[model samples]
Target: MSSLKTKEEGKVTQREILGCLKNCLLLLSD
Candidate 1:
């Protein structure tokens, strides 16, 4: 159960990072 939770946390962090990166790129492009 702990391992599953850890994996989910990692996925969420990765998604957050990706979202932030996308927003940064959009701002730079504008």
Candidate 2:
């Protein structure tokens, strides 16, 4: 159960990182 929770957290963090990267790219393109 604890492992599952950690895995979910990792996924969320990865998603957040991807979102930040996307925003940065958009700013650069502009």
Candidate 3:
């Protein structure tokens, strides 16, 4: 159960990081 929770958390963090990276790229392109 703990491992599953950790994996979910990691995925959430990764998604957030990807979103931030995409925003940065958009700003740079503009």
Candidate 4:
């Protein structure tokens, strides 16, 4: 159960990092 929770949290953090990277790229392109 703890492992599952940690995996979920990692996924969420990965998604957030990806999103932030996308936003940064967009700003650079502009």
Candidate 5:
């Protein structure tokens, strides 16, 4: 791939996005 990225890095990004999404949902629910 031209972009260049490691699997571990992808996993970490996914986790951060998920955490942000979870926090947003919680705030909306309240």
Candidate 6:
């Protein structure tokens, strides 16, 4: 059960990182 929760958190962190990277790219392009 704990492992499953950790995996979910990790996925969320990855998504957040991707979102930040995309925003950074957009700003740089502008």
Give per-residue CA lDDT, model 5, range 1-30, as digits (tens).
Answer: 534557778889999999999999999999
* TM-score of candidate 2 versus the correct structure, residues matched by position: 0.85
Per-residue C-alpha lDDT of model 4 across residues 1-30, encoded as one tens digit per residue: 999999999999999999999999999999
Highest TM-score against the true fold, candidate = 4
Clashing pairs for model 1 are none
Q: How much lDDT does each candidate structure score?
A: 1.00, 1.00, 1.00, 1.00, 0.88, 1.00
* lDDT of candidate 6 over 1-30, digit per residue (tens): 999999999999999999999999999999
Flag regions of model 6 displaced more than 4 Å.
none
Q: Given candidate 4, what's the lDDT at residue 12?
A: 100
With candidate 4 superimposed using the best TM-score fit, by how many Å does residue 1's alpha carbon deviate from the native?
1.3
Q: Write the per-residue lDDT of candidate 1 for residues 1-30, one digit (tens) a residue.
A: 999999999999999999999999999999
Q: Tell me how many clashing residue pairs each candidate has.
A: 0, 0, 0, 0, 0, 0
lDDT of 3 by residue, 1-30 (tens): 999999999999999999999999999999
Clashing pairs in 4: none
TM-score, structure 5 vs. true? 0.75
Output the worst ten-in-a-row residue range by lDDT, candidate 2. 1-10
Cα displacement (angstroms), candidate 6, residue 10, comes to 0.5
How big is the RMSD of model 4? 0.5
Task: Give all candidate RMSDs, comma-separated.
Answer: 0.6, 0.6, 0.6, 0.5, 3.2, 0.5
State, as a TM-score between 0 and 1, how close model 1 is to the true structure. Answer: 0.85
Model 4 regions lying over 4 Å from their true place: none
